[model samples]
Target: MTDLDTPAAAPPRAGALRHAAPALLGYAGVRALGLITLALWSAANGKSAHTLLTARWDSLWYTRVAAFGYGWEVRLPNGDVHSNLAFFPLLPWLERLVAALSPLSYADAGLLVGTLASPAAAWGIFAVADHVYGRRAGVCAALVWAVLPVGIVQSMAYSESLFTALAAWSLYAVLAGRWLTAGLLASLAGLTRPVGAAVVAALWVAAITSFVRERSTPPARGAFGWRRALGMLLAPLGAAGYVLWVGHRTGRGPLGYLDVQGQWGNGFDGGYAFARFVGDKFTSFPSALAGVGLTVGVALVIWLYVSCVRQGQPLPLLVYSGIVTALALCASGYFGSKPRLLLPAFPLLLPLALALARLRTSRSAAILGAVAAASAVYGAFWLNGSGPP
Candidate 1:
């Protein structure tokens, strides 16, 4: 069916929120456990969980943007320059707005935005899985996402949840054949992060495929419409608009954004740098276990993509997850941050979620509970240890 195929959405089984409640509640419970564990662990170490969530790592960069605006940079003794320009503006912009409207500090505002966006992201993930498999699979998918080793990032003042929320809803809109809604949300997603391109790519691929289908299939119900064409036009504007603005501001033309990223040691090198980093981990006996772990993680990610393809997921999902995976894994730097980067690639969990859905309720719940506790403990330890970049 074409993008105009509104009837592509299944007949109303239940009101969206009413149906998504299980996923949402399960997600909330998992997140709560994580936060509680973090709180207790941090307290025992004389640290504040709130500080970790709102003031550390990239959260500092985001709050800096909200408080002082951009054009900030950190020049290190090693000749590395970290520029705030490397960060997309939408999250910081929202933080600024939230701070202006409330008594909360910029950091707190950022945490608030992420806290709200986490549930939205979960709901959107539930929507997608439910549409593709069934209600039970959807619940499992959302819970699966919650139990991710880096799932604690979803609750921090980070852009991952915000971007995922926008991306997931945009994808849902695409699957529902609401072309305009899809494009609009995709545009917003693009505004949120560099990975937003994955959503734009998904929309473009789906729209182009629809065009190809229309060329062969006779015009009738669900045929390509002007809305699809307009959606195709709208999908890239957010990213392009921001990049072009940076270009003009930097006087470097269209590639100025790339220069900004480079200033922060970020660029696309097709995983070469990442491979080297992982390989180096094996140079010392003390680090070889981590090296092997990294290799296994990469292999697992790749196998999941293959499973998605073999499972015959819709083109939009396959394209979206593929690009998200490639970008997250292939990035030249931020080797330790790759897992956090994959937060938006929720579709990768569908295969496992579908399998989990087949288990008896008690068995699945027990397994999920154990996994969730482990994830929560690991999240606490992670933040207390090296932590995410």
Candidate 2:
């Protein structure tokens, strides 16, 4: 056979297997080790590992929503309504679906979804990295995400992993010019979290940039025309519709979601609130020293964004990453829980992934192993119990 026909006729199975093996192996190792550490930590703390990892804090809320279906509300001392409507809904919906088919309870179903979604999110991140950089960079990006201290949360009964999976794939779809798919995924991502704004913003920016570029380059075959652009416009429909419907039910406007978050002591204030809080922390002696330490930490986040921009990352990534970072930092609510809230912004892992990619494979694996172990242990406390307030 001719070389062209020979290569084309080669078995696709081996190639598919080869491509899938590394991602599967790497993600399995990360999740297995993380779960082990979480279990051991729960044992040490005299808590049931199942309950600790699957049924606490926000996870409990999600489980309750899935099992009971909203309508349960309590008037808090602060006069706020604590109801399932306060949550964005996608996670609970998944949990309910899983529970319906599986032997597992709603809480366990939530856990299962989170566990599966973690590796899926990692895979999506790898695809984005590979597309943006190269295969080596993709491996490194997945490794960084796999071993992140807060990544364990992604494996618990939380929406972060699911949201990340949706957002990453949505970003990849946008980059690939699959407008309808991107729009649908973006809508689902928005249904997962308030920060799904990042996904919507990324798609809008990508669409606008593509329109501008098309003005210069001659129209390519099969390119998204205005019709595709209109589909992209329809993406925010899911998120907006849900929020507005909830608001209408509650006799609140489209902005009612923000008002609800405010009841929980959160809102977006353009980083001014965070600045004032940091300033006040410096007014006391010992607290001033602590503020200095915290400033160093914030400086690292600033440096990461600066470095990413300097490296000339893709516009969609830069825009999405910037939105996530700004939303997390400038959010005027629950300042103490900012880290947890921002955990799904996997783009922040990119710089660190690039750095890790420079190391030998074995060395990098060892380092990741150690960090994953530690993160899993720390995650037990962080996910199950109350974090610093």
Candidate 3:
């Protein structure tokens, strides 16, 4: 790699805190706005925001897993069975840990974990962007992620926040050449979400490229060798271990976890199912408009990724974002939740964030503030109505 391509070294803890303060504060403000809006909307609608965030939908399943260790299933009227094993174990494990140490219930403990982790995720995002671009871009990137329509999930009793925190830090570690740290974080991410494989893949690609580069260059005495190999070995263990354990428990052998996910109508079909879903959306006028919007959104995401490649973004970020986008767009379940699933693809926002950073401060603030308000309102309405599934 050229000197320009080398990853920026991380600032010390105190320096990092100082540098990232604005971004963290901005992200926290956006989340606080979303929560306040949700609280007001819930009160007006005779509902509880706490219950909405902590006791509903996937949150309930996570809490159940935390309180009782898996082995739960729900049989739908359509004769489909949904197994709790479809959910990864990290978030629940954290919830259980928090609940054990505190007076909180499993659900509340989950809320607490998500609440704390969201800002940490933002910080990791800022560190990565700052390393790639600069502090202003980093701050913008964090704020952009914060104002996403589905950003409220970051503050709920969900695994997205936790997983994003791990993924972001893992990517940062990879960029900084901290192989072991990257691998450990990637493994934890795998334990958190299936998409964690994106992280593992990025690390693997980076390790391979480093090995090739070292072989071509005049090797220094102490160089990239055992550490990189060890990281590659550690990277897949978390996801593989969980999947194998689930298989063993369910008596389905190696494919047991796939069977569990299949019960939920989720599997990798190389985007065929998603293509059909979009086509079905065009059956009516209103639905056709929705389909058009979906198509445009997907196109925009692809264009942004291409922009990153054209700009020669680091290989790790490119690989990580590409895998994340592919998985989110191609998932076969919960059509309405694809946007939420795309939350971890934060690098996709970096190009836009850089543009925003180049704008005048007043202009950028106005744009971000307007979007944050709209996102907060949308999040409130979404939760009060049919939120992410």
Pairs of residues at least 3 apart in sequence or in different chains that clash in candidate 2: 266-333
- Whole-model lDDT, candidate 1? 0.90
Instruction: Report the candidate with higher TM-score, 2 versus 3.
Output: 3
Candidate 2 error regions (>4 Å): 1-17, 220-222, 279-293, 381-385
In candidate 1 the C-alpha lDDT for residue 243 amounts to: 90
1 or 2, greater by TM-score: 1
Name every residue pair that clashes in candidate 3: none
Return the lDDT, model 2, position 273: 83
Candidate 1 Cα errors over 4 Å, as ranges = 1-4, 7-14, 222-224
- Clash number for candidate 1: 0
Alpha-carbon TM-score of each model against the true structure = 0.96, 0.90, 0.96
For residues 1-389, could you state the per-residue lDDT of candidate 2 as single tens digits? Answer: 11100112222767744654576578778778777877877778787878767876788888888988866666898778767677888999999999899898999999899888987888788877876776677877887777776767777798988999988988877766677777888999989888888999988887777676667766663254754576477779878987897788778888777666677767888978888878888998988987787688678878988888887777888899889988989988676666676677767778878877788988877887788777776776675567632
Q: What's the number of clashes in each of the models? A: 0, 1, 0
